[model samples]
Target: MNRKIYISLAILCVLVLSLQAACFARTPDKLPNVKILATGGTIAGSGATNTTTVGYTAAVTPVDALINNVPELKKIANVSGEQISQIASENMTNEVWLKLAKQVNTLLSQDDVDGIVITHGTDTLEETAYFLNLVVKSEKPVVVVGSMRPPTAMSADGMLNLYRATILAGSREAAGKGVLVMLNDTIHAGRDVTKTITDRVDTFRAPEIGPLGFFTGDKPVFYRAPLRKHTVFTEFDISQLTDLPRVDIVYHYANNTGDVIKALTQAGVKGIVHAGTGNGSIGKVEYPAVEAAQEKGVVIVRSARVGNGIVARNGEANDDKYNFVAGDNLNPQKARILLMLALTKTSNPEDIQRMFWEY
Candidate 1:
């Protein structure tokens, strides 16, 4: 009949190229790619009334409309979005934390970048996730999401917290496990996550250490493993760090006369943290204006406003005769982001108190 119709069209082109090589050898393996930079907080907030979640209008939606309203985050990573900033995470800045830590260490020194989420704004999202858990030298997966409502409110929890922060940034067991902070489904440990309830969507929490795990249905179930010493064992190298040393915190209270620690050490502020009262003591009329701003060289540190624990390096705060450096469980705004990257590498208060007890 025409050579039997060319052998039935060559056996239907070999079963359509063997079913397109087994559908390209099973498509599911190509997932982990994650990028999502965005920095508008309240998960790119905006509210005119979806039942308004507290006078909204922060970071007013962008990063591709917050990843196109999270279309289930394309079945978990291979995602991409950039938008760097829109504001209102309390106007977070150290120049946007050195432009989001040099664009997250230049997209994690790419080789097809396998992780990084960051959508910040839960009011300084744990101080930019503990300053990218001490300058991300990339152990891979660096999450840091946010959302205390305001993605247009009404049960709006930023699209399931940006789909569980893109499945914990394409988890490979969230590699190395340092800078993470996913929201309600919990995962914290951007050096001890904070933000305890103000607008509530489970307002993050890691006090006394309570989360390095959670997200049951979507997997990622860790169980305590952040022994500090983060990312490629960090030494705080912001790759030629542009500028970041004016640290300041000061909050003691109860007739506190630390005059904002001699007015932030006469507004030159090399370092200051304070935030004392209980374990981080300091308000006996604010220790002689923090002992004259540490005899003018200015390194202080203390930290406590009693929100959780650890401020203990030396009991009643003599801290080795006033060279002061306690802030252990961090929290005076992450002890001013580790005293501004440990005064950019050592001003020596016992080597910045062993870099605040090993980061």
Candidate 2:
């Protein structure tokens, strides 16, 4: 009887092991992991009262509060937060950009991290998004999110914007789309999206090319793809870059003395983006100073101050003769970004022009 009992116990042990293995195999797959890198904006802003909207302390809210207030996020993915900085987007600098890029690349290299979401200020959100669109080395989704209303204000938009951004980051379809800007239930390519409104939640837009897609009924939908080359396809790599080349923008206006252009040249800027008026034409008064700067070895790129349309190559002015490259639909701020990166690689106008067209 004892021998029989021992054999029975050994058989039960074997059966238990087999059942455990089957249970493990039948379990559902783990959710995608997402990281939220928070750089304060109005989304985290707090005002004196819930009724106050405009005048408030920006970047005062912590990442933990931003994440904890939205409990529904856990149902979608394993989300984590890190506070990179606490400042308004207007104060965003090149140093923060380099630090953020390095951190993003490091996280993307890890096998467990699938995607990333950035909480930024709407003021300079597009600039950061475009900068990341150019330099981030990974194909994983990087969605920059922000809100026009302060978190303390009525009808606050941060909760939903953050929710949509988190969902988009975890989406498999978001891969290889480069950096994305998700706000007002819309998805835009980082390279083209720009803030169109100052005080509205639906501020971001890509005029030449509309949004890449949108989020509806709690799901992300894609109706188009960005035609421009981005992410893994581009040549920018910021891993070894400690400092970016200095570039500035000078806007042209009637009766403008071009004093800013002369001052920028004296300040030893490597490149200048002339925000010319009406199809990127240099006004008669601003022409001599710009020409002088160009002759002083400062690369000048002509970009239109108008909200829409491209600065046509040799349309209003002879860019070839003056060695000035057309902005190619890139706004002045974005042109400054590209020029800073392009100057790092090559100073040749032709090579820089090709970079502008391709990127």
Candidate 3:
């Protein structure tokens, strides 16, 4: 009887060890599949010298080189790369935005693709991120990352940013939170983040709302999520769109004649974003040209030049009186993105106003 009991215990232990081994063997298969879509940016840039951080040629490095340089990414997720565009973000066009958004939708719809990371230039990075935030149809994580320093720089940040972005893209916790802008180990909501500094690694910040989370080593830690409607909840769709409507931004300054706005109107722009001085305030001289533009059936939106604070409707300007839409907290560039998209759905100022409030 004693021998039989010992034999049974040994068999049970063996069974447990086999089960553990099987689980370990399947670990790689269970890892999330993250797709890296590379758009040219400083992250993929190459400098003349290791110490030369600025004046580097961007989009010179191919997507495959970026992935192969960071081998640690393979341990975290099943990683793959596809080059979407090879242009700097400053040169990022509406055409590229449309193509990128379509590709993102297609990839995320697949069962095998779990999440996506986009490498973009910091200049207009927020614009592209915000554009994706409104149009991407998935609840899966989408992270936009860029670097201030080129990859050839001594303290190149692209590899680490890429690694962190991939981790966030694969993280289940990042789903449904909206598109994220990851840089300097900090995670920001695409809708709220903007480039504050011209040449700093920590340039991106969501001034009013702050960051959604941080990458604590390989793990993503969250503090709060954006309350705004985004991603799957947004009404904008770009699947069938070949191009976005023409939109222009007019800056407000002292003693300014709205000649730029008049020119934009004459140029037949579909919409115009007014970067008002304060509180979305229009100057006395500039108001008439703005009114003239609106009279021509041009949709006008008032956004603050001041980075922080909301551009409330009927506060400094009578949005109701002019049938204009307030930009809410969105800056001029982002406001233009929303307006271009909003025009696709409706031309009515009231309808666009509601979109601003919600999205």
lDDT of 2 by residue, 1-359 (tens): 99999999999999999988876452325667899999999999999999887888899999999999999889787899999999999999999999998999999989999999999999999999999999888999999999988888989999999998998999888999889999999999988889987787777999978999988878999998887888788888899988899999999888899899999999999999989899998877777888888787899999989968889999988988889889999999999999999998888889999988997
Candidate 2 residue 165 C-alpha distance from true site, Å: 0.5
Tens-digit per-residue lDDT, 45-86, candidate 1: 788989988888888888887888878788776788898888
What lDDT is reached at residue 16 by model 3? 100
Ranking by lDDT: 3, 2, 1
lDDT of each: 0.84, 0.90, 0.93
- If ranked by TM-score, best first, what sequence of candidates would result? 3, 2, 1
Decide which is better by lDDT, 1 or 3. Answer: 3
- Model 3: per-residue Cα lDDT over 1-359, one tens digit each: 99999999999999999999886552778889999999999999999999988788988999999999999988889999999999988899999999999999999999999999999999999999999999999999999999999999998999999999999999889999999999999999999999999888888999978999898878899999989999999989899999999999998888888899989999999899999988999888887888888888899999989999999889998788889899999999999999999999988999999999998
Tell me which of candidates 1 and 3 scores higher on TM-score: 3
Per-model TM-score, in order, reads 0.35, 0.91, 0.93
Clashing pairs in 2: none
lDDT of 3 at 117: 99
Which candidate tops TM-score? 3
Model 1 misplacement above 4 A: 1-26, 33-51, 55-69, 76-121, 135-138, 152-157, 160-230, 235-249, 252-272, 275-299, 302-332, 336-348, 353-359
Runs of candidate 3 with Cα error greater than 4 angstroms are 1-26
